[model samples]
Target: MSDASGERQSPAPFLRLVRGNPTPEEAAALVAVLTARARAVQAARDAEAAAPAPRSAWRAPSHPAGGHPPRGAGAWRRSFHPG
Candidate 1:
């Protein structure tokens, strides 16, 4: 199938499965399974959205350099770049 722009369409997995024209009983089972899976995904998403944000233990270091304090006058050569 094509879309309004006349580009070839990609069939979703359910549509591809339906193209085989399953028996009525098989079709009913497939629908039930798909519906259950969809509900499970929605429930998981809702749970995640309702969960509390994580608490952070990290705090900015007091060093004027913005991160860890310099070890010595030549520390810049060995130290990671601080923001």
Candidate 2:
């Protein structure tokens, strides 16, 4: 947002100490944990976004009722499609 002169306004603080006062080191530790957790969550999101989407059941290879086709010529190709 801006004022009458169009000067940018700073937003409210993202973190606030509502309870007991903590030493600088303790506060840093808390912030480190929160920041690490946030980064880990973001990394997971990034990995999921980069992953290939799952194939639909219709697009998935058809397995034999017995699980795998018997060993024989064309068995490999037969396992991938419905007869």
Candidate 3:
């Protein structure tokens, strides 16, 4: 693209090779490492999102909601009956 001159201009490179001039293999290696890191981070995020939430300590009953009736005759049978 060009300005009023209508001359073709080179597009700016998105990934600039800073500092040392790297060989093609080195650039490919850098890209591979970056991709792997990104994938690992995304996988961790997905696992966290899919994992079941832990029950709150306060919300759960510590022991069975009700215990045996005061140890009297036929109390065992009463235990089975709905509260």
| Highest TM-score against the true fold, candidate | 2
lDDT of 3 by residue, 1-70 (tens): 8978898888996466779989999999988888899999999999999999998766676644454355
Q: Give the range of the ten consecutive residues with the poorest summed lDDT in model 3.
A: 62-71
The alpha-carbon deviation from the true structure for residue 44 of candidate 1, after best TM-score superposition, in angstroms, is 0.3
- By how many angstroms RMSD does model 1 differ from the true structure? 10.2
Ranking by TM-score: 2, 3, 1
The CA root-mean-square deviation of candidate 3, after full C-alpha superposition on the true structure, stands at 7.3
lDDT for 1 in candidate 2 is 79
Q: Estimate each model's TM-score.
A: 0.48, 0.60, 0.56
Residue 30 C-alpha lDDT in model 3: 87
In the range 23-59, model 1's lDDT, one tens digit per residue, is: 9899889889889999999999999999998755463
Compare candidates 1 and 2 on lDDT and give the better one.
Answer: 2
The global C-alpha lDDT for each of the candidates, from Candidate 1 onward, is: 0.76, 0.84, 0.80
Residue pairs with backbone atoms closer than 3 Å in model 3 (clashes): none
Q: How accurate is candidate 3 locally (lDDT)?
A: 0.80
For candidate 3, the TM-score is 0.56
Candidate 2 clashing pairs, residues 3+ apart or interchain: none
User: Candidate 1 — which residues are off by over 4 angstroms?
Assistant: 1-18, 59-83
Native-to-model Cα distance after best TM-score fit, residue 1 in candidate 2, in Å: 7.4
